[model samples]
Target: MEPSEHARLDAYWRKIASEFAPDPTARPSSLLVTHLLPERPAFVRAVGAVSELRAVLPKPKSVVAAARREVEQSYRVDELTRERFSDPDDAVAYLESRAAGERIILLDVGGYFAPTLNELCTRFSGTVLGVVEDTENGHKRYASGEKLPCPVISVARSPLKDPEDFLVGQSVVFSAEALVRGRGDILHGRSAYVLGFGKLGSSIARLLHAKGVHVTVYDKDPVRRAQAMAQGFGVARDRDQALSAAGLVLCATGSLSLRGEDFPTLRNSAYVATVTSSEDELELSGLPAGYSRSAVGEHITRYETTGHYFYLLNGGEAVNFLHGASVGPFIFLVQAEIIAAARTFTRAELSPGMHEVPAADRSTIAAHWLNYWNR
Candidate 1:
């Protein structure tokens, strides 16, 4: 079925159809995705799913492989015409080689590194219009003064709806539940330390607190710390204070907040997980040398840190997207936000600066989501 026809039944699809305006300055036939998206099927199928989730994207196998190949086998990769890159530099090099009139839509999760984005903004400027950023790390860069080419959109924390609050709530329930699955009442009376009192951290702290765990929130920002304290969640007085006797340490801050120096204080059997969009949120570099490591199956990694066992789900990537299968559908809902944001770049006269999903478009996504879910 044509994309328009599918839009008839799905409000989300309809919104995508209406929000996506073709670029007036360039053609948009090609696409490139990358490591920024580790195992996200929603992004891999974003373009094609505008027709509906099940629609087979007529694009070649190369299109699906633009990022990770985990989802490629499940999608239609009928051709090998488009370029795919596991290395960010290779993708950058490809952009540098593009001639005028060869612009294609670029969907990336991590083009935020100054040097990488600089290459695209200068050497490969105008080679593409759709530079969709789907993570908090990427959003932070847009807030930076560096200018890239035209057409950029971010769905991580859009001003329009900013569903991070809702998404994080769901993520906590699922990720926390995963940590306790078949493991007895680990959270019933344990001390839970959550780094970053941002949307995700607050939610995790709230849920954990409700579960009878002592929730302590650690955020470098004073305002956020006050918010956590006001919410009845314990605020970490200091960095080391946050890890003191923490039975469960969860990192929600997108920064390298959890590191090796903090490990010595992480109590034995203290479970550590990252619930942020960026993997570096829990800096593995902080793990002390000579720590034993093993895979505990189901994408969980067990590490002996400071003479205690620490379980890092999905290699400290986003736990909700990995071991928390129950959290899957909700993240997909956030993907609707992503699709809406990307659609904005297609038509809006945007600049190199970071941008959010417009209010009108954000409302469309929320409405369509409610309609689709019958909520």
Candidate 2:
């Protein structure tokens, strides 16, 4: 990076560190796996304040050139891609090699390395101090696995994350609107379907409704469906029917909510977007044989199969990530919580299992956030 860019980033990092005030004595060696976007520098700086950052595993789709360069200059950079780590086993092998007998904590997003971290915890018990997961999908991944041997600290469900998720939902809509508008289309007054009524999904659905779009929501969980209905949004009883009728579909579910079978049911010219970070949320590989896919616009891909065609925004990854994955300084609240969780894990003897950030840590982080932003 240029001298000016370096100085600016340094100033920004200092600003964040002063506000978050990470514990200086809680420095655990850590391997960070997350999106490498411009906003990530502050997160890295905050974590580095209380953790010995050994390396970074950047999610391929979320990498921004400038951020990647800065991180590479400061720490080891390992790009997580199919070519680098063919499968979960390969990823595990690489992580083990990287650990090199060090007792390091794993900081992850989307649980991309959950299986690897789980195996490491067993193979080299205690050497893998613990894991700090940032997303709900990662939380679910660790939750679904067999009993974990080390604590898996999760900030996914923290009330502190609500502000970030809320803005994330807004960004999803904003990006979708920009893409649609680029094609001479407008989101206002359009019929939309939101697949998943989870925190992010509900936020997206509500934003779309507020913009005068007719929003229909579907979730496999009956409770979520009821919640959507209670919020006065249309509840989709028949998934395929809703897809066929809506002009836009936004997926926030961290699972394979849309696959080949559902693609053909989409309205011919409809646009699809996702708020989840991983491509597993859409499962484009499930698209039937003879399907043709091509980039139709910046961050938009056109997929055609069985006479049905639709656009996939941001290549089926989180649409908000196309622009920096930021919700402004509020995101640093969650980042601060992650640091606090890491500090707690290193200092306390918590038993192995899924763990939430302690209330005290969250309270402290929230207080700092309020003080910083309210000033």
Candidate 3:
């Protein structure tokens, strides 16, 4: 007997799901471990499900091999640099070749550098500058710490372009792309106020305005405020002017004050979300001091209390850390663009204050990722 249309559709959906679904029954992939420390070995394997977790222990050497593979495959040295580096020494040599005439600015913290590797990287970089320390709201990671032999600058308390000697790459560039080119209309035509006018906030405003959203931007800095006005944005002189007349409020300033009281002046129907950092927990407003809350996390909280739906992201964390990573191809495209910029600019001069990744490189990365995805 022929299956019904609904049955066929169900089967098709199930088949699609099976392709991407985590395989519980399949044996876990082998472990590769490498422990630089003699006493401790590094472990490598994607862990998921109970059975997968039970797989054998990792050996340090194997981890070393896996890390090398990650560096090579992810960096695509064969295509980008036209040569392959098999070992750490070779990789160091390759980086040296690239850095022979360039200045390298590294943000060191979070155990990102080991004492030995730190010495090695310093030696490898022709001109190495040290970051001061990671700060509460900015590129402190890139600047914070003991300054290296070369010129060191603090990203937290300085504009990037002031000391234009090196290039910055190797991170997400959502703000730049979203601002200059606009983005998918997640909140179009909504009365919106954006707090913060740095890279992320500026990008959000640019995209929101393109979608016809009336954007009132509030930044404490007069210079940034003027820049917003120059871009045809409604510049709010203070929080009152910003929060007073809006249905949606977006915090991209990396401000941690997205609590309910911050927007006390907002209309009762106004909703709030963030694109800077991911919020871990969400709480509803307008109820008793303590009300039932949603157990949602990882940014993307939708609340329906007063007959209107309000959304909050990661409690209000960086949007990219939540929804952005899920769109792997989108990120790959961005990274590829950055990589191309790294390749091109390795041959040129770089200006400061977080330079925008070049457009041609962005195009190349986007095209490569798109083609790869289609394939």
Best by TM-score: 2
Candidate 2 lDDT tens digits, 1-375: 467656654564465455444346545678888787776865776667666787888887878899888777777887675444335456656666676666688888877666555566655523778888989888888888788878889999899899999999999898899889887889986799999899999999989988999999999999999988899999988988888998999988877778868887788889988887546688677777777888887878898877778888888888887666578778777887777777777678889899988798788777766765665
Which rank order by TM-score, best down to worst?
Answer: 2, 1, 3
Across 251-343, the per-residue lDDT of candidate 1 in tens digits comes to 877667677677666776677777654335765776678788898656566787455676665676666654323332344455666666655
The CA lDDT at 260 in model 2 is 67
Superposed model 2: Cα runs more than 4 Å off: 1-26, 82-89
lDDT of 3 by residue, 15-98 (tens): 322322333442222111112111111111111111122112222111234344543332222221112222446545654654
Error of 1 at 324 (Å): 5.1
For every model shown, what is its TM-score relative to the native structure? Answer: 0.74, 0.90, 0.42
Q: Which stretches of candidate 1 lie over 4 Å from their true place?
A: 1-11, 23-89, 96-101, 110-115, 144-151, 159-165, 294-302, 305-309, 323-334
The models' CA-based lDDT, in order, is: 0.58, 0.79, 0.40
Q: List, in order, the clash count of every candidate structure.
A: 3, 0, 33
